[model samples]
Target: MTSPYAQQGFRVGFDWGPAGAAAVPGSIVAVVDVLSFTTAVTVAVDLGIDVYPYRWRDETAVAYAEQLDAVLAVGRSQEGITLSPASIRQAQGVRRLVLPSPNGSTISQQLSDSGSTVLAVSLRNTSAAADWVAARLTADPSLTVVAIAAGERWTDGSLRPAVEDLWGAGAFVAGLADRGVGPLSPEARAAAAAYREVAGELPEVLHECAGGRELAAYGFAGDVVVAAEVDISGLVPVLQGSRLSESSKPSRFCPVT
Candidate 1:
């Protein structure tokens, strides 16, 4: 059997605990902040900069950025900033903010300590990331690309899968499936597509979703819409540590959804 990262081209599966604990050291972790962090990372990539996930929102981030040749500081909150490219340009450390918030970066942080090359991907840049993977895994097509869906939070010895996040992942799987790329298992394809079929409103799609309901109650309709765009930019945000930026390939565009 192939090692997990061997399967992902960088081992690291997408669960919080032991199931994913195997994902450490030399793995390529794709942090999926479908709601916000991933989008923030995408915004940074659109500007043509690289970012790293922060170990701590408090000092480590600032300290790390301080060490970079060029650094930016970014933080995410449900209450601040517009995801629009224009607004992203105007935001503080839009290029390099120490992400410490409710969405994507938190997951990025989890894989930070791991030596894996962490990459932030979404529906918009799913193909870019996938193509990158395909190229690298040409020698090891069995590479495991774990799609971390930012799902529902709970305490029942089980965490729930967020509908919107999973839906996005399904679109990603479908896109890759269409191309017959990577270790995108049938289970992954089904997981992402199964949820894509059910629909009402964006919020309705994410209804019962641990995070989406919260996003709905807080009036993030615009965000939900942005998160669901099938293949908007073809940009994938690969994580260095505290800030995120484009992968090795910037102009390489592919369609996964």
Candidate 2:
């Protein structure tokens, strides 16, 4: 019980738009913009959320909070977004609170600031990334791992808004933490397997997306596809405030290769 088993660590799920899904203090924060920011952050947000297709993100925290139907308290920045008492009603359905993010900026930013160890995840590196995080728990047991999907836009479980980053991220979570791999819940296991089943070229899938296409116009087409793979980075970038930098990198809890 002195190890990961004894710790108060818990697993939770949420959608990461610009305002990333929030993590508990001192938890591990994983960000996946299988479509954009994972690529966009790697490249740079200076491109302004797509120069042409131009992303849509709110200006401030107060305005974003007002958009929700319930008293859903949202936290965000240009980096990522997070929600409290994780629930789907806040995500979709009639009068759904539109997630304010160009890609996963706000959420990305939160993961950076939350003091939680952060890893950029996707369908590409599901095994490797989660292994990287789980190994860390042996030493730091108070792990609060939050898988914030670079979610897609859905209406009545069909279509409305569009994006693919969430798909890739979801698959990674399922592959690594769910399905009995890492003490995950059955619900999480089901979700993970679902994503893994369709896991493929994440970036290409989202290339035609609003933000992805916009990025292409801004001369960042290749970046999207590149960020889709796992273990591609020699450095698993960390989020600090609104910036993705190598300085916050975790101390090799698992092999990057």
Candidate 3:
């Protein structure tokens, strides 16, 4: 008999936050934060900058940046080194950046410490990230992956499922499917289905989603647009320690609903 725990239910699975990540057992983990963090990291890595995930923009982050000799991102709209994808893409003379976010960064930090292979994924690099992971799985056939969507929180502190992230992660799962990776778990199958449903309408869907409209109302709609772009980037960020760097065509990306 297959023990319930032994089944693990998901070899390629999708879940929301750190708790969700913990619930899904996998040798590799992918963290998705499409509206921001992961989007910003993808942009920064494409520009050849290393990124560090910090949970807060506080003194601890400042000190950590100093320790890593990295630039700390300010507000998403601030003048210099902010979390804006545009800023990170345009900034020069910086080799490293520490980006802080409540959702993505927290999950990245948690996964990094969990000792699993960690990859950061966003809409910008979905295909690349998934392909990277798939190649590894094909090579070994013993590794499992879990894509965790770093879902946003409500103002009153509740889990707010962001559609953009679902799309990002879904695209990842779909990419793995395209590579003929597995009999995907139910959660992974649903995520891939979600991606196929919205693949052609990604930009409009993101623009109209709650998070997209919220950012647009705050005058950050360009960020949403950037986050919606699929596979324009070739960068795949792999988390090693607390910092994220381009994984040299040997890394990964994935999931949520």
List the global CA lDDT of all models.
0.54, 0.45, 0.83
TM-score to true structure, per model: 0.68, 0.52, 0.92
Which portions of model 2 show Cα errors greater than 4 Å? 1-26, 43-101, 111-115, 122-128, 152-163, 178-181, 200-224, 227-230, 247-257
Error of 1 at 66 (Å): 5.0
- By lDDT, the candidates rank as 3, 1, 2
**Which stretch of 10 consecutive residues in model 1 shows the poorest summed lDDT?**
248-257
Cα lDDT of model 3 by residue, 1-257, tens digit: 55343326456878887678777767888899998889999998888788888889999888888877778899876789887787777798998788899999888887776778899899999899888999898888779898888889988988898888888898999999898877688877887898899899878999998989999999988888888778999879998666688886332321000
Per-residue lDDT tens digits for candidate 1, residues 171-246, read 5555555566544544465655664576334435654565655666766645555665545666767654344556
User: How much does each candidate deviate from the true structure in C-alpha RMSD?
Assistant: 6.6, 12.9, 4.7
**Which lDDT value does model 1 have at 87?**
40
Cα deviation at 53, candidate 1, in Å, is 2.2
Residue 176 in model 1: shift from native, Å?
2.0
* Model 3 TM-score relative to the real fold: 0.92
Question: lDDT score, residue 180, model 3?
Answer: 88
lDDT of 3 at 67: 75
